[model samples]
Target: MLIRYTPGRTGLAEGLRRAARAVLYLPTACRLARDPGYPWLNAGAVRWLDRHLAPAMVGFEWGAGRSTLFFAARVARLTTIEHKEKWRRRVAHLLARRGVGNVTLRFVPPSDDPGRPGLRPALWRELGYEPHKPEFAAYADVILDIAEASLDFVCIDGRARVACSLNSLPLLRPGGFLVLDNSEWEKYAPIFTAAAGWPRLDFENGVWRTTILRRPGGANG
Candidate 1:
């Protein structure tokens, strides 16, 4: 399932290869956690990271949990933020069992009231958080509070796209990469558009859309 990059079409083959590599690299005892249903770093995002960027210095994945263990293996340090303590604990336990040592997981309670009436209470019970409280705001605040200057790579898989975008950009070093999954979602388009100024590359329709706005030597335009 190797997809080569053609002139016009984005090569999805590399991404697939990277994903396969991640799976193969996983220990036999922990292979089941890498399945597609995992909450973090879905198959598509994993493939994209493998193809476009090298392993980063500091990697941040918002709302991605144990599902990103494979990606975590590649980076020097990974910081994963989840709003629910249950998810945090679950991911922490999984990482420990897998002997994954590089990740630091944090549980940040949400700041806004869960918009839906019944949903908030249900989620709170399920996640072991207090009911009727906003959980996402705290998550956003903690990320902003981090002292680091720039990040090598960032993956936004949480709520608050605008906040994520603002917070993430400052962390990206020059030439650093930012990957936002589910960009096709209507809410994320504005953030995507706002990122238009950066030299960008995207993979859509099973192909790469490489947009090199400013090359090393000069601007593309």
Candidate 2:
């Protein structure tokens, strides 16, 4: 069964109730260790992952940036795939400045036509993230080429999210995690169901919806 994030904020009283609950119940320590200057995953997801992602594990992400640094600190090695040269270069500089040397970044060009079904929808303005299509398909291929079951974690938070999600499923090691950010979009409903074999945890923290799906077995802590 799929767990959905539907917060019903009917009025001020109801909103305040949630706010009060958050102050009392939410775990503040699970937030990302540091602010990386961009939107990352939600707090609950961060907390869960921080507790579970051990330093010996290896990780990968479809798009790189603040997340590159974020995961690098937790995992032993991290590889990032990016389709934009400009973004890749900028992220590389930040990584260098921060002295994060364990990450490998590969810049793959957008190979597919920009127009395609399930490719682009008008979710950019509302969700602040857009799916990169044909180019994304190419990027997904690079991730698929990674040795099967070799990565301990994979994050499909960048463009071509769906394609990356499909490819990432097999690349993860048993008990590994596949994290998809901005998962509340209606268009991504299929992804949740398709990931049937894994244990899925959905988190909604007012600002973003993040889904952490695990491959079979216990999470590597």
Over 45-74, each residue of candidate 1 has an lDDT whose tens digit, in order, gives 556566654564677778756446756767
- In angstroms, give how far residue 159 of model 2 lies from its true place: 0.9
What TM-score would you give candidate 1 relative to the actual structure?
Answer: 0.61
> Candidate 2 residues 1-221, lDDT tens each?
22332376477676766666555433432343335633377777877887887889999897887778878888899999888899999999998988989999989877764433343222332344445465555676676457778889998877767767766776778889899998988777656655676788998865458899998875442
How does each model score on TM-score? 0.61, 0.73
Scored by CA lDDT, what does every candidate get?
0.55, 0.73
Q: Find the candidate with the highest lDDT and give its number.
A: 2
Question: What value of lDDT does candidate 1 attain over all alpha carbons?
Answer: 0.55
Q: Give stretches of model 2 more than 4 Å off.
A: 1-34, 37-39, 113-132, 219-221
Residue 64: error of model 1 in Å?
Answer: 2.7
Error of 2 at 152 (Å): 0.6
User: Candidate 1: minimum summed lDDT over ten consecutive residues — where?
Assistant: 210-219
